[model samples]
Target: MRFQTITTDILVIGGGLAALKATHSASESGMEVLVVSKGTICSGSSFYPLMEALGCQAPTEDPEDNIRLLEEIRESSFQMHDEELTKIYIDEIRDRVAELPAMGIPYRKMQGGRIPCFAKRARDIFIWEDWNAIRNKSYALLKAKDNVRLMEHCTVIDTILHDDHIAGALCIDRQGSLFVISCRSMILATGGFGDLFEHNLNPSDVCGHGHILALDAGAKLVNMEFIQFIPGFMTPRYKVLFSEQILGYCTQVNDAEGRDLLARYLPSSITSRQCLDERSKHGPYTSSDISRYFDIAMMKEINDTGCEKGFNLSYDPKLLEDKREFISIYVDWIRKEQHIDLLGTKHTIAPLAQASNGGIVIDVRCATGVNGLYAAGEVAGSLHGADRHGGNASGSCLVFGHRSGAYASQWAKSCDRQAINTSIARKALTERFEHHRPNRIDADELIKEIRHLMWYHANVVRNERDLVYAKDRIRQLYEDFNPATHMSNPKTIGMAVKADHAARLSMILLECMLLRKESRGPHYREDYPEKNDRSYARRLMVQSTADKDIEYRFT
Candidate 1:
């Protein structure tokens, strides 16, 4: 069947903060913008506000507050993000928040000259009136834009390249119809790849399609190996993501052995709240002081004894009862309201699984090496080198998202149709159908096997031998690609393309993980236990040089 074709000056492939910013900037720049979201913009990974970890009491209005905090997080990302891009969004985050108020978001703010201390540390965290406000406001912006087109439940399969220039995109709608959308410039804001792991605090839709698209288009990637795990999101029965800001400040009572284990982990230099330095200068300051620093692998053994004790010890029921019934209601609300199947078995959690600290390579303009393509939000690798600070993520959404879109729109405005070719898009769509037909692998089985391998080899600890094992298994999975393996009755040719895009994302992370040998901030090496800042402090980049292999270079 002949598919429908749409044309715009620019196309943004995500519905998250970055895509919204890019679409807004493109329309504001007077360029026609088209946005295709994998799911409803509000339902994707961005909407899941893991607020328990926040130590803030209220949001900050200080103009300089966002900028100062972000510089610190960017320093954590190993100074890879452009300083120019970092400053812009951090400077404008308040406006982004304020915009929400106008969009039916009852933004929480100081009433009549009253400013409550939102968080314990004003510099490290801020309390949103409501995190859900972001999801609600974006709906209004989509409604108001005259030149902006919204394509919901759509997947961008690949780019259309003509003479090495990205000309347009190939997309598949939910109805099994192929659509070719041509745009002078494209902003890839499809977010991160947290689903590559077995248990993820991230929404499954965050498959890092933006990064994969850029790679296939010949753009270089940096630090794909570094997948930052938040120690708090222990899954199975509950998906409670305790805030880093709170843990960095408050005291944690780990009842693994019928009592708090934090006492055993506490060191001589500090005790109680003092042990967690609010002014921690580095990502993982002292190895013993970092996240999951004192090993609690024994806690798993303790978790098994919970069934005999009555109350499951993996998660602290005291957190719900003590924090309040409101906390329980709020946690339950996320599951019922958002379809997060996190309530099954009692699970033990450490401070892990927050935001991804690594992603695709981009300059101040949010452009990868490939022209006409840009990345933003969590998907675009920002300033979080080894680990990100508590307040820094909010800064990134404000900063990098704005810069990527501004540059994408400006680039779109200057281009004509001369550089575009729609052929590459057609090929991507056709190839997608080939992979989805009838398959033996179920999504559960495929994901389960993938999670097991990744978690075993690539979590907080890593060694050279296990990483090699990870590589071999991943290559085998790709060779035996099957889509109908987990058919949800929606398996059509179009969905195959999305799966292809998703698997490539997993591969990218594994490839990058294999190259980096030394341990850094979030990416740990059990074998290379020491941080050899001498040879590894520089950013590691993977460029497509010859044959399918990446050529690694340090900057």
Candidate 2:
């Protein structure tokens, strides 16, 4: 019950590229900024640098190229993106990307010019070859700043609101100690909820707790149904993201039963070679193309066989022999970093949860509609809708990360820090951990259950029946959860809190998926099976009402 109170002008929550960029921008305002992360600073999906590297796309110097890039974004996202935000991204991305070099984070520059990835001709992307160097330099720069303070191994329990505005946050450190962080403004750059699934490429702590925090603060989350699933290794190296670039070279794919996986799933019109070629052009699974069958087959194999290790996939190195440029970079990086020879290895592949394109809705300025609160990066929604462009993930992090921090700082400077009441946070915490029930749910077990439930029912393919089952099961799990019984061990407290957050988020996400009732982007319903633009074109938004009920509406 004992807690310490800390006051700051701004509070930034997250540990990834977005959080670090926000911190850097906020520090410029000369305000007292406190960054709290569940993990170490510079950790999260961005640090992982999947595929070729952590790709960041920006507009080329040519004006026509920029226009084409904008068109490509709209086309690629299935016209589901916010126009205003998309324009802002295209216009400001170049400047934001330029800042990287000054921060000592060097990117690969090919001889000709920008390297385009993920099937976009107009789009030019820069890949960071050395993510560790970027992480170290980013940390060093932020640490050297006088007004910024970084707190690691700290989990934010909930957002504290006063008069329906951001006041502070309730947090707990790695130890059992509690801290009340009062700030004029708070930024949620806490990445995505990929960790909520049974299989994901995200770090252990990268659950969508930030989405729940934003909802609690009365912010609406948009496009919750659009989750990006990528092909990743299920064995040899579990959850290691398999590059889509190399997917084209996959000569054979067979399930444990020796059944040809792709051949079994592909439609009569599409050949295995054609599917692989189309699938290789993009990373995330999309209903927009025939390539979707690649991920669909993988998911189906896992679901049908209940094979935890997924299917065996073998690649032809001879296919890549013609493309030495790719071999030198991607193939070599895999060999050096992952300790895997892509050509020589026969690995198990499955549809792994990669990122969430939909999240807490933010405007052009990255404001989350709620005062004193903002969101950026993967945590912020409406920026990328349906299917996101390949490099836009890291690009949006920089563009909106700076926007959120700068705007939050500007807003913070205009107002005085409000006195935050800890009663609400305390009450919720007590309700969560105060129960003395002898029979209590295990947080770790609950999380595993939730992950399996999500992956099986809600991931890749969904129908009303499966989605409803997921929703009911999540509600049951929530009712059964009693964290107080496990309070004796402080380490488990964070896990317990995360489980609760994941359950709440999972319920909302399921509802959104169910409400859409149409196939669009990553949110494909097997029952619907087709995109219905007339009925379900608009983005779905979810928010928490005053009565503690979730409200959903089409925007």
Candidate 3:
């Protein structure tokens, strides 16, 4: 196969809000910036709003309120976050959010002003009008810049290293053409691995490829076990995110067999009303509160019956009569945009993988402990701990996205462009495409197997036996699968590469889940039901050794 080489000062490997912010920051320095996306520009997790609008949280201008907000963040994360980074996030998020209005991003205004969605107090959140406005305006603004260029429908397979530092990246377009992206610096904003699960709300291309790329290039990952799972519609509209705000109004929840699923799994001590009330307080499932039983029951039901459709929920609007403020906005949006009437329809809901709370470990400046390599957005880890606040996902995209871009640009300007080594790219291509053996394994089937394994064994509820079995199964799949064998059909090469990365990442995530023996936040181990702060309080870091074996350490 032949290779085409493209040179740039900075290479950004995503098209989400974080990547756009990074590209915007880097372009201001007059450096040529190239953004490569797996889909169209501005299309990632950040642009896929589950509800009528997307919430971006920022501290209120009040000094005392900001202090309270900071404390709440630490409490919500269960002290799993870096205090330095938490402080930076609280101090800078307001200004970053304020800049959005100027870029043509409109905020949803209410009578009492911004309402706190997931927090008790002082956690001010600004909701964007919708995903379409944000994408169009952001795309138009970036396209107007001279130094910024965007390559859509392009997937970056791996990063190339020279003398233990990043030199460039390897990528493939939709047409099966190969390209070598040579750059002085590279930033990863590829989002998370929600797509690895059978049921997830993420885009198809977000399958933890960035995590694998970072690990392959000698960077450490932390909190791989702390994935956030939220309820999503499984019936009428599969994979659509279910609003947690409506959970409180649910009057009845039944399985496909028309049985009381929640009552069967929920302990007798916890009343159904109590459980539903607590569950409505947050979007993601967390063991930190009593609401965890709601998720546990749903998962147990799915596992017991092998019913992928989950449970049908019937709600009464009378329950939300007192919550006029919430109804006026959320319920109205549901009626107008989603075209679903909660009072008239019964919807099926299941626990769907939402976001990753852990990823590549980065410093305050967004450097991933590798020279010329930086990370931002959901792909960058440890800004959040076990559970993240409702809107902090978008907030982090703005803060770290800007930081990674500015810092990568500064680093690139101070250094000379690295020489390109075509041999490295050629060797990688040969190892992946030169095999003469017959292709026995299908990439599509392999991906399906991995997704099923993860959703059943490793998601939401985990135990030693299932996790160990999953780890071994993934390792076996990774060992047996070979993209080179399928080189005759070039269209399948990208899928093979994606499946390979998913298998490797699944192994690492299973290892992390096994290492943390205690249940904390979203990571619940049935065998070890209680949180053991003394034994497993610190963050766990995983990296690839020189021999290509996984090694982990506690910080």
Per-residue lDDT, model 1, residue 386, is 61
lDDT string for model 3 (1-555, tens) is: 667889999999998878888888789899999999999988788877656667677766788877887788788777688778888888998878877765557775344443343466744667776677678888888889899888999888778877777888888899988888889899999999999998999889889999999998899999989999999888666777777867778777888988887788778788888888898888899887778888888898788878888888888767447455555577766666666677776678889998999999999989998999999999998798888887888889989999999999998887777766677787866664426544456788888889999999987889999999988987677666777765545576678789878888998899899999999889999999999989988999999998888998878
Go through the candidates in order and give each one's C-alpha lDDT: 0.59, 0.83, 0.83
Off by over 4 Å in 2: 49-52, 110-119, 324-327, 421-428, 431-439, 484-492
Give the C-alpha miss distance for residue 476 in model 1, angstroms: 1.6
TM-score of 3: 0.95
Model 3 has an lDDT value of 0.83
| lDDT digits (tens) for residues 461-555 of candidate 1 | 66777777877876676556675342223345444445555555665566666666766666666677666767777777766664655566778
lDDT of 2 by residue, 348-414 (tens): 8888899999999898789999999999999998888798887888989999999999999999988
- Best model number under TM-score: 3
The worst-scoring run of ten residues by lDDT in candidate 1 lies at 111-120
Structural similarity to truth (TM-score) of each candidate: 0.77, 0.95, 0.95
TM value for model 2: 0.95
